[model samples]
Target: MIIHVDAHIAYRFEEPTDFLLQMEAAAIPEQALSGPGLTTSASEHEAHISGEDAIGTRAWLRCEGDFTADYRITADIDRHLVDLDALNQLPPHQLPGATVPYLFDSRYCPADRFQSFVEAEFGELSGGARINAMVQWVADNFSYVPGSSNATTTALDSFVERQGICRDYAHVVCTMARASAIPARFVSCYAPDVTPQDFHAVAEVFLADKTGEPGSGAWHLVDATRMATAGEIVKIGVGRDAADVSFLTSYGIAQMQDKRISVTRG
Candidate 1:
């Protein structure tokens, strides 16, 4: 599968502001950059860094006055698709060191608060089956309202309100999956079918590998909103929550003037 992406963002900064931006598709083994790859606006002062889990690239930029970024990329996706229901969940003791942290509570996804609820609602299932059910529950129970949530919204808030955007939906999925003893992390991605044509948020769950070796597992993408499937998602990065993978994070105030994103498949 080949996917093309184009995004433009314009913001006004009153004074010089430092920003961390992660807007490029990751070049993981499953996904290869093709064509001209990625092109972005160059800032006077900018440095590139490895994204969370070293899955992608991030840039630190210093800008003032009007700031704009134009990004374009083409990706060749060769993702390994699997049946979530057939995958087994690794116990905490069996999980890899890197995946262990995803099982704990995070700022946006407080897994601790969802333990009781997960136990009651998804007790009959285990591993990928449980996660599949939880994803469906979220999709069925929540409403997708664009402006219903803000940056401060957390999984608990979304759980109660049952309304929010992609990030909120992702937070809830991460929270519930972790509460069920599954190592789940948040993923920032792009997909061709996104309704609002914006950066997409999804969850990644670590499950036993197809090899079935003890303690062997791989991360798989799960989107409760059902907008895009794993094979079609172009992952940007992975983190415990959205805070670690925001497309743009400004140290100082930045007022948005215009933002446009387009993604298509060919």
Candidate 2:
């Protein structure tokens, strides 16, 4: 499926402030890009290509007054969503170096606190089954209340409150998978079917190689909200948790005056 994505963020600042932004759809192996994306800012500035992997290609700007970010991209997204029943976990040593960091606990997703519960619930399961179960556990149990969670909310907090937005759902799933010794990470995407269309967050777990390839496991995408369908999930970034991959990070204070994200299938 082909998709066109557009995102706009307008902000007001008290004093001069620096901001880091990520708003372009990734051109990955599965998602083929037709052309270069276009990014424009209200004020002139060069965006630095930063971050370790495909996680950042951002507009780093210092604006004293107001600013706006507009980014657009076109891609044929071939989202390779896995069968929840076929996934299996890989041994730690066999995991790629890049995947190792996801196995440990992070700020928003504190896996250590949930280790016991994860072991008890997923001890006998491995791979996709555990992942599917976790996704289902979150979807069926948690409420999708938009204003219920904030930047400081953690996986533990979401679990107790039983409600949050997409990122909160992602944190819980990542925490659970990490506790189960599965390498899991948070992903930000442009979801096609997401209501009131905005940026969306999803979860991914590393599944062990099943076709006689012990060290060749792959990442399987999962959405606890179950709003986005396959071929419509366009990823933008991947990291241990939201802290490492938020769409926007600011060095100074800025209040959002207006924001909207549009994702349309063509």
Candidate 3:
């Protein structure tokens, strides 16, 4: 599979500002299953202007690879591994899942509120069945709604609202898994064939007891936002939460009044 992605972010400031700085993690890294063919980043910075000014930032990334790899699985849950190739390929700065202490933001701590929901849903099933059940539940109940929430939005907020984009959905799922004592993380990336959106979010749970191989269990992708199942390929940013791997940023006193993203795949 091969994919091309374009992301654009624009902000309008209320008054002239001296400086702006932003950290971007929109570029997807190559892994064992996929290869990054070509990738590029471009930004436009401006100085003090009139009452209203605008700043635009864009990123273009191209990737290509076979959809199936040596580690690809068909249906069985016991064949999962950590895909060490993928881990070794990542840059030092981006390696957080196995090394970082907290993938989610501190503000979102205290996950007691969401633990009960996970236990009730999967308590009767085996570990593998429990994960599958949770994934199915997310797919059945949520609907993707972009521009519905932002970084400050909490999992409780998402659960109550019942409507949000991928990030919100991923946060909700991450919270549930953590509450269940399952080590889970947030992932940000693009779904090339699904939609023309610049950014997307999914949750990866470490199903240690599901693989039947003892400590050999691997991370499984769960798309809470789109409610997608396993076997789908999507570029991803794995972290503790949305704050750990945000796709866009703004420096100075600018406000992002409007933003849009479109993605396409073949």
Candidate 4:
């Protein structure tokens, strides 16, 4: 499928400030599944009138690409050796307990909440099954709601709120999988097919299956935001958390007044 995407973010500062710096992960990186065709980004800054000055910052991005992916069945469950290289490539500075078992203290921790749901639905299922179930469960229960939530809401908050946009949903799934001892990462990118183009987030879970051929591990892409099954191919930017890959930032006192995006696919 050929997809086209446009995203825009704007911030207006209450008071003029000295500096601004932000890391943009809006440009999607070519990944295991998808090919990139054409992509571009641009930004504009404006200073307000003389009386009491305010800083205004605006950014716009447009991306076009073709995505082709093949679906694969879930791999058999078994213990497989971890691939150190692949593991190392992941975002650093994640919550410390990620690779070890300990009481997860972060207010954002989703392990306990996911565990409760796993027990209620599929008792005694192995970690792999629990992860899969969580993926399926999120897809089943939630529908995407643009502008419903932002970066701060927790998984429990999302569950109770019952309505969220992409980031919240992805956080819910990623947090749950990591809590279950699965090495899950958060991804941000453009989904050209989604209406009202904007940044999107998804979850990728690392799996090991001893039953599979030697030296092979499995990866699963779960799209809680769209309730869509992600295949191998898609534009992606990965990070331990949203802060690591936020598309836009301003150091000055800028506040976003309006933003818009548009997407189309064929």
**Superior candidate under TM-score, 3 versus 4:** 3
Candidate of highest TM-score:
1
How accurate locally, in lDDT, is each candidate?
Answer: 0.90, 0.82, 0.49, 0.49
lDDT of 3 at 183: 61
Superposed model 1: Cα runs more than 4 Å off: 37-42
Task: Give a tens-digit lDDT track for model 4, residues 201-251.
Answer: 777676544444333445556676553335322333555555544555445
- The best candidate in terms of lDDT: 1
Residue pairs with colliding backbones in model 3 are 103-240, 103-241, 104-240, 196-262, 196-263, 197-263
Q: In model 3, which regions exceed 4 Å deviation? A: 12-106, 193-196, 209-214, 227-232, 257-260
lDDT of 3 by residue, 86-187 (tens): 321122234334533432334443457866777777777544455556656766777667778876888788788887777777777777666655566777
Q: What is the lDDT of residue 246 in candidate 1?
A: 95
Q: What order do candidates take by lDDT, descending?
A: 1, 2, 3, 4
Q: Looking at candidate 3, what is the lDDT of residue 43? A: 26
Question: Which pairs clash (backbone N, Cα, C closer than 3 Å) in model 2?
Answer: 87-127, 87-128, 88-127, 89-127
What is the Å distance of residue 86 in model 1 from its true position? 0.7
Collision pairs in model 4: 12-255, 13-253, 33-232, 33-233, 34-233
